[model samples]
Target: MPRVVSALAALALLAWSVPSAALQVRLVPPTPRQGDTVMLFVGGTKGARDVEGSLGGQRLAFFPYGAEYAALAGVDLETKPGKVPWRIGLVDGVGTPRKAAGILTIKAAGFPVQRLTLPDGMVNLDPQSEQRAANEAARLRTLYDTVTPERLWRGRFTQPVASRKPGEGFGFRRVINGQPRMPHAGIDYSADRGTPVVASNRGRVALLGEFFFAGRLVALDHGLGLYTLYFHLDGVAVTEGELVERGQTVGTVGTSGRSTGPHLHFAAQLGRARVNPPDLYTLPVRD
Candidate 1:
């Protein structure tokens, strides 16, 4: 079913708190779990404006909401469970700069363990593959470290595939050949070879190329430090620096890199926070 969340329903589901004071701040879901997206709501008389904030020192972007301001925050899947401080500063309608601070108790999340056996050579990268992976990692970091402040993506984020068929769950502890590897950060959707993959939201294509493990890939810069990545593609249709709509075709699914079958690995990032793309789709943000 499509996720259409109402304003009233959004409050109940997020477990947000409203303070009695005229000016107040609340974190949706109150306590954010790993691989989750967070929404910060500021309530005030004449409302909040020019809102600026940060979590763990990463800059946050805020949008004006009538008399108040709100911002989207991403908590990385690799974040350790503990107290995380988020600070906010905003100039009200009166032009007075007001600031507030809060602590988000990063809660623990449970992920399933997945063990799979692949070809020995595939599991172990060769020298050439290692070099490619290293170069790609450095290139990817340069793209992610860039923080775009524009609000390019609007409304609720949609699935890249029309069927919306679910695949492997995010945050899985992946073990290959008895060796534990990095946790699976993105959710997957199984599709046939040459299955078309579309953009999840409006954004400018940042990078498009064949990588070591990602295979044919496309990454979008959705502005405000938000990015969505599509990996293991059979064909890359979009080029770098192209603006794409929410449902624009980006690539095709295939068993392109270090894989056993055809699938699309969709990943999301907010600033430097690598989050679960599927989890972000559940949020109730409007244009």
Candidate 2:
């Protein structure tokens, strides 16, 4: 009887020593390239009440996905190719907070150079135009800094325009008017002027304005610090703060901005990272 009692005691001790649950983390792509959008999933969190995380110093906004929690994060176009640290925190059912850490491997992507010749006035802005562009740029930075606490998009994202032509020039280094300029942060879609442009997914119209460089622009807030921008529009169809649905027309394409021809400039931002807009379509978001 004593031997049996000892065996039971040992078994009980083993059970007591092991944790009931452990925190788990996963990145959908496992390995991502610069300018790619990543989907982060956390499991083994059966009793977790809340979850939060950060990647490369940028905050991640988490939302419940079935039995797990997930967030969308972006690797900027200029992010150096290497390992980036990521950390996660979880609040359990009884309010006990736990933490987990890992590294994300970012692969290098080659971006080709693009050269164009434009009017000198457009390439080199006048003093007044320079100041106006600077002011508008600052406003855009402020808008991207705000994070919406919930996920407002559903299912997969679609192309913003119906043109059969594929997007081009994302992350392209541009030499315009014989002067080097910032890398192109968005993709261009060649289409006829007044071609309908629709929202890639459900979102709220965040801003609509005419600017020195972007021309008529419409910015959409898709929550969780994710935004989509439509630039160089011939016309705007929605007002700021209006809730928009997937595939709804937000504007029409045109060469309103500093452009050689009629085309749509579609861009995306996750937090402050300028990610490729097409990457949004590959995410595993549910309807």
Candidate 3:
């Protein structure tokens, strides 16, 4: 009876010494390339509730994954190649807060320089047109920078064009009219005039208007600081504030904005990261 009691006491002591399983997460591609997207996989919270987290300061949008959850991490060109941090917080059943954190390493992505010799007037706009371009850029910045905390998209994103191809790549160091210009920040698709262009994902139409450079354009907000823009559109099928599904026709290809030929300029913005539109196509979706 004394031996039995000793064994019981030893077992109890071991249990007390062992720490509880932590509610923590691991970063997929723990080191992400600039302009890429990574997945944050939260583990040990199989049955836990109210899990929340952030990767490199950008708020994460979690989706159910069996018992645990996962979130998408966007790494933009602005993310300098270096180490960053990841964090998570959860309230346990007893209302106690649990927290965890780790570091993320960012790898460099090199972009190529592009020299486009468009007409002098097209490259060097007059004062009025320059002001219009500035205003258009400001309007877009405000929209992309706006944070809509809800996740409005489902499934992986799709290309706006049927071919799913790109013309000039994103992050092109542009030199136009012998003057350096802001790097081309979007993926261009060569399409016939009147060809259909669809929403990259389910989203609400945020803006539809004519601009000096983009021409008739449509902007869609997929919430969670994710926004997609379709430029040089010939026809706008959706109106501002309209909800559109993935692959739904939002506009038609056109040489509307300052363009030499009909094409679709499809761009995606995740918070401040002007990432490649196709990067969104690779993000996993939740049911």
Candidate 4:
């Protein structure tokens, strides 16, 4: 009887002393390359509906759970060199409280970042371009205000439709008339004028309009201010305010505006900040 009592007490003590690693999340790349997108993996715990994820000092941009993992966007891993802290915690569907966190390291790419150029005769347009850029910047601010990082953490991302071959580089520097310009904002995929364009993930149609540079465009809001823009589209498949599913056809590729050939300028945006979509695609999503 005494032996039995001692065994039970010892077992209870071991249970109390050993900490349960409820969830094991590590930023896959301890030292992520510049312009790299960091992905977090969860282990040990299961059945979580959403996982709150944050990078640097930012709050959770998307909540990912289930078999699929959620990801953050607009990370310029090159700009901020050094250790980047990340945190993840589970969200209880019924209001039970539980959470966890971990740190991630970031290393410098050491390569010179790319830049674009502007036109020569546009030298005198400084005030004009500055005003326009400022206006656009302000618009982005408004968008980011509504799309907090926390809201994006509500769901996991669905697998993106394969492009096979992407056309444009995400941050390729451009030289216009021997003057530097803003680096390219998104990735471009070569396709026929009418090649179908699908949603990278589940999202709502946020903006459907034309712009001087973007041409006929469609912006899908994937909650939490996370959005994807399809520019130089030959046609729009969905209307404004329409809820689109992952892989749903939203538009067709084209060379509608300021383009040399038929292609789709696929861009991903987190709030007002532009991020490289290819980075998200490169990360291991199935895990």
lDDT of predicted model 1 = 0.82
Per-residue lDDT, model 4, residue 73, is 44
TM-scores for all predictions: 0.87, 0.93, 0.86, 0.70
Candidate 2 matches the true fold with a TM-score of: 0.93
Backbone-clash count (model 1): 2
Question: Please, what are the lDDT tens digits per residue for candidate 4 over residues 43-99?
Answer: 654455556667766665544445434555446623566666667666544434457
> What stretches of model 4 exceed 4 Å from their correct place?
1-23, 43-53, 62-64, 67-74, 88-103, 108-137, 148-165
List, residue by residue over 4-50, the lDDT tens digit for candidate 1: 55766777756534332445887887998988899888778364456
lDDT sort, best first: 2, 1, 3, 4
The residue-level lDDT of candidate 1 at 164 comes to: 46
Pick the winner on TM-score between candidates 2 and 4.
Answer: 2
- Model 3: residues with Cα > 4 Å off, grouped in runs: 1-19, 46-50, 63-65, 164-168
Would you give me the overall lDDT of model 4? 0.64
TM-score, cand. 1 vs. native: 0.87
lDDT of 2 by residue, 84-163 (tens): 99999988775668789989999988989999999998988999999999999999999999888878998889999977
| Model 1 alpha-carbon drift over 4 Å, by segment | 1-22, 45-50
Q: Where does candidate 1 clash, by residue pair?
A: 47-67, 48-68
User: Whole-model Cα lDDT per candidate?
Assistant: 0.82, 0.91, 0.82, 0.64
Per residue, candidate 3 scores C-alpha lDDT tens digits across 1-287 of 99999999999989867766787676766678877778777777755677788877787767567667777767886578999888888766555567888888899888888877788878878999889889988998888779777778888888888653555668778888678888777889998899999988899999899998889999999877788899999999988899999989998999997887889988888777777788777765454
